[model samples]
Target: MRSALLTSGTVALLFVLNALFTGSLVSGFAMPPYILQVLCLAGINIILAVSLNLINGFTGQFSIGHAGFMAIGAYASAYVTVAWGDRFRAATSFLPEFARDGVLLLFALAVGALLAAIAGFFVGVPSLRLRGDYLAIVTLGFGEIIRVFILNIDVVGGARGYSGIPKLANFFWIYLFAAITVVVVSRTVKSSFGRTLIAIREDEIAAEAMGVDTTRSKVISFVLSSAMAGIGGGLFGHYLMYLHTNSFTFIKSIEIIIMIVIGGLGSITGSVLGAILFIALTEGLREFSQYRMVLFSLLLIVIMIVRPQGILGHLEFRHFFGRRRRLAAPTPPVIP
Candidate 1:
């Protein structure tokens, strides 16, 4: 009950802040459009990073095809909104315009996430049996296959790219879903199921010897992660009102992997921080234009050399603070 209340309050607070930023609640006051766009992109990246962290960080699966699932979600959701969105809006016309649009967006997102989950299940079942580099290869191939498959499909625009998707995503919806992704991942990590995943991550053979279904746990994690990625993809598509296979390439997958690595594996808070910092740096370095990639690569190299375990190193913010508190505590009297 307390958790529910806290979640609700947080959501309400986000809504109000989104309204204020968008100037819905204040006269002649609004965040700059470019900044707001960056924030929304950060929210989407948060979803991607946190979800990938679940599969790769928490479960130690080493899958790097998140962009594939995201692509699936983007195209699937775009198709729904492009085809049936008007029908859904008309059916829900009794509600206020905003509410009706929300419902439509929700339905489209659900469709996209569902399809992506299905893809994850199929991919996980066969490919998850492999480990380490083999697993990475399989997932990499899968992502490329998805991209190529989408590229050939004329229904979704083929080489022309899919367009005309409804622009229903906004700051409120994006951040609300981002917060949900974080909560869901954090709760899962603290649950018994998550503990089993961790056990597998630490030692798969030992976990299997202890009667834990390691493969099954990994598959479940993959599916959940893919669904979350799909949600991010859906938001991305709707916000841009377009879809392109080029956007979900191997480089995109690498970028997400880099975020988790820089943030620290197996740390949810680290994933969030990593996403924010990654996006900020990418945007901040835009002025360097010709030298942007070189500068970004150098900075990442420095970070890795200085702190190889990442900024947080498998620890959450709470854990970090608690450790400091313990260290600062007075020493107990020696009985001598």
Candidate 2:
């Protein structure tokens, strides 16, 4: 109870601090627009990395198709806001005007998450049974399938791209959801179900022998991961007020995977760090123009060779907070 209270208080304090820093309260002095944009984008990337970590990091599943779920969420939320924003707001106009728009955006996020979860369930059923490269192939195929379908769908702009979506996603919402994603994922990972996932990760055969329902665990991971990605996607689409089928392709999925890998698998804090750095790095490298991708790829190869476990290597934020490590006691007492 004390720990939970501390966590909540910390989160609230963070929200307050962020609002102040962004001048959301004062309204006169504020961060530069580009900086704010980067921060929002970083928040969204945090959600993406953490959600993908739930599958690839915690559950030991090598999923490479997270972009599909993200795409589903993006399009679903975009459709809601674009095709039905006014209708949703009108239906809730009885509430204060500010609250009414909030309700609409929240509803859109919920619906988007639901759609992604549904997609996850079906994909998980078959994909969960595979392992390693096979699983990667299945996921990659799923992402491609989603992209191709969206490309041909005229309703959501087909190959042209979606635009003019209501800009419902602001910095506040992005940071709020990013915090929620971290908290929920952290608590869930420390829970019993999360242990089963770790067990599966460590050794599937051994975990099965110990009565862990590996299949069920994998499926659950997929669903949860998908749902969070969907939420992130909703925020992403609305924030930009535009999306294209090409944006959610396999390459995008690769970027998410790279963030988790570079951050360190199975570390929630690592996801946060990785997301921030990844986006900043990409954005900062824009100076290279055409050669940026090549440079980024080369850098990744060097990092992988030097530190394969990632930047954090399963370390949590609390681990760096001066928590004492328990040393094993001498066996001399037993001899006596």
Candidate 3:
């Protein structure tokens, strides 16, 4: 009951904070739209990093094709919204315009996630048998294939890109889903299944010897990660109101992996922190766009040399900021 109440209160707080960032409120406060948009983008990146961490960090899978799933989700969701958006709005006649669009946004998001999961299954099932660099190579190829395929498909504007997608994703949806991603991934990492996944990560042979289905767990992790990335992609496409095949290329996948690595692999909180800091850095250096890549490469080298484990390493931020409770002393048993 306490936990339930706490969860509800947390959610309420998130929504309240979200309302403060709405266009009207921001305009009232004279806050810039770019800041709001960046915040939303950061939230989306957090979702991507956290989801990818589930597979790479906790599950010990080296998947370089995350952007492929993102592309699938983006294109799929964009197509659905463009083709069937009016139908969805009309079907939700009882709802307010904003509420109706929100509902349909969620539906479209789900559609994107489903399509990504299907793609994950096909990629994961066959390639999961491979390990290490082989898996990485296969995933890289997969991402490239997806990008090339999308470039040729004129239906989605092909190489020209898909445009005019509904701007349904805003700070509210982005942050809400980002929070959900963290919570879900956190809970999942603490569950029995998570332990199994971690065991596989620690040592696949040992885990298999212990009767854990390494391949199965890997596939499950891959699929779950892909689904979340897809959802993030849907959010990204809708927010930008455009989709380009190039946007979901190998470089984007590298960016996500960098976020997870610099945040601290195998740590959910680290991934979130990493995404936040990484985006902030990227934005801060936006003025030096020409040298941005060089600057980050140097920074990464510094971090790798000075602090190999990243900002958090294997520890949670809670360890630093959270209030610590004292353990109660055990009462002495009375024999008499």
Candidate 4:
């Protein structure tokens, strides 16, 4: 009951804060409302980066086709929302009409996640045999293929892109999902399954010798990560109210991977912090325009030189809290 109350209180506080930002109660040199947007983006990217880190960092699978999953989710959800949303809204006129307005959009988001998960399984099965740079190339190729397919597909507006998507994304949904992602990943990492994944990362051959189903584990991680990335893609699509194949390109995947790498691979906390810092830097440097990417590259190089392990490496919250408790404990009387 205490935990539940605490959760409720936190949620309420988040909602209130969200309301303030949305209402433009806060303003500054940086359009404060846009700060909320950056937060939302960071939250979503945190999900994507952490999930992908499970595959690439924890499991040592060099897959780089995250953008492919995002593309699948984006177009699939957008198509469903625009085409069948109004129909469902009309058909469900009986239930408080306002509810119907956004429900379809939510349904589309679910469908997007489902489709992306399915795609992950498909990609994972075939590509699991490859590893290292080869797997990276294959995954990169997958992303390119997805982009080309979207371009040729007329149903989703092809090269012109898709528009008229419902603006269903807001702080409520974004943070809610973000919290869910963080919790789920954190719990999973602390579980036995996560141990198996780490073992695979350390030595896949030894893991297999020990009867661990390495392939199955990799596929499971890949599917889950892909599904979450899909959710992010859906959120991005609705938030923008329009999307193009260009949005889910190789560079986008690279950017996300950079988040995981700079944040500290294999660390969920690192991913979250990394996402926050990356987004802030990306947005803060917008004024520099042409120099932004250059600066970002230089920053990464500096981080690599000084701290190649990434910011947090694989440390968890327990590390700091545990230390705090030890420090706070009363010291015994010193011997005379």
**Can you tell me which runs of candidate 4 are displaced by over 4 Å?**
1-3, 24-31, 322-336
183-206 in candidate 4: lDDT tens per residue?
A: 777777779998888999999999
Number of backbone clashes in candidate 2: 0
| Residue 311's lDDT in candidate 2 | 92
TM-scores for candidates 1 onward, in order: 0.94, 0.92, 0.93, 0.90
lDDT string for model 2 (128-215, tens) is 9999999999999998998898788898999889989888888878888998899889988999999999999999999999998899
lDDT of each: 0.93, 0.91, 0.89, 0.84
Off by over 4 Å in 2: 1-24, 322-336
* Global local distance difference test of model 4: 0.84
Tens digit of lDDT per residue, candidate 3, span 53-85? 999888888888999999999999998899999
Indicate whether candidate 1 or candidate 2 has the larger TM-score.
1
Better by lDDT, candidate 3 or 2: 2
Q: Write the per-residue lDDT of candidate 1 for residues 69-158, one digit (tens) a residue.
A: 999999999899888888888888899999998898899899999999999999999999999999999999999999999999999999
Candidate 2 lDDT for residue 183: 82
- Report residue 221 deviation for candidate 4 (angstroms): 0.4
What clash pairs does model 3 have? none
Task: Identify the leading candidate in terms of TM-score.
Answer: 1
